[model samples]
Target: MTIKNIIISGASRGIGFELAKQLCAENHQVIALSRNITPLQALALPNLHPICFDLQDQDAYKGLVAYLTEKQLSVDVLINNAGKIINKPFEDLGLQDWQEVYATNVFGVAELTKSVLPFMNKEGHVVTVSSMGGVQGSMKFPGLAAYSSSKGAVITLTELLAEEYKETGPAFNVLALGAVQTEMLNEAFPGYKAPVSAAEMASYIKHFAMTGQQFYNGKLLQVANTTP
Candidate 1:
């Protein structure tokens, strides 16, 4: 396996945190981004660098890009794991609620990735973590209308990126994950037991983030035993 410098968004907890932990254990440089990085800072891993700021903050985004440029950092893998889910019925979902979800889930990912592209290695991979509900024909659950719509947008965004970068260097792909046990999942489906654990999902994401582009480019992979 090849180990290289990687950047992970939304890494203060859950799948993102686990990914940072595992990757840092392997001696890869992991730049973990989150709105609150106190939990990450508590880990105290030398290889784990935590940056605290909302992805929607343009100043924070520019600061990150500047830091990378000043340090001459070349990201080998960029994982867009940061996301926000709004669980409200379609009618109850206000415009602000939808905007908040899309702001972090879609626009944030796009802005961060765009800023990093100039600093990414030619053979690097850009992986976005989406949801199974975003997939076409997937079973739809009520109250997740906004969340699902944002993820669906991400899938299409990733597909278009794959095509746009086909003849280019860095490969783009999206992982449509099924129900995974995490704080977010628990909040989304209160008391429901998800088939996959956060650790399991993190391990799979680590593998794909490290090597999926070798076998796939512009692909939407489903990482769950059950779909929808």
Candidate 2:
């Protein structure tokens, strides 16, 4: 059967917005979420539904499960595409720094997955967007300590779900991608060097989200052009 309903986080802009736009173009119902009270005008597609809510809000997801439950929203796919990276030295990373990253990157994804699990079909797919730093530890970068660690946590979480969901596991995978041209990078670093178009990454991610691998859960697939 053709999967129809897809729920994506971080759909305000960047890869998330692009993916939502493309998927909706293909006629899939997309429930887009982000940490903003303001609606995302970027997703003007016919099948896109935007929810303006911040991940840091304590009661943001309180009634989410119940709402999905009441609506019987059968999610064919869940894309955990939300995250942030703070560039700074390890010592410079403070408590608020860690909280900020985890709140959006780790905690939000984990909570949203939990909220949507009951509504997700057994054969559905769960795709999390991780970074190349998650795979290699990114020791070369000065400001990626917290960012890299958060991604590592995401990877670890994906592995656990892969093992636990063996029988009825949602087909899962982590896209360890390279640079993508988006507001995320520019916002994090006003003068960063790594450059890649977000549109390309969105195209790749949208394709994979539709094609679920039966045995590739917890595996990290790198997508950097620098590699020959």
Identify the candidate with maximal TM-score.
1
- What local lDDT score does residue 28 receive in model 2, on the 0 to 100 scale? 90
RMSD of 1: 1.0
Q: Which 10-residue window in model 1 sums to the lowest lDDT?
A: 219-228
Residues 56-169 of candidate 1 have per-residue lDDT tens digits of 788999899888988889999999999898777789989899889999999998999899998875589999999988999999889998999899999999988888878876
Which portions of model 2 show Cα errors greater than 4 Å? Answer: 1-3, 37-43, 137-139, 193-195
lDDT of all predictions, in order shown? 0.91, 0.79
Model 1: runs farther than 4 Å from truth? none
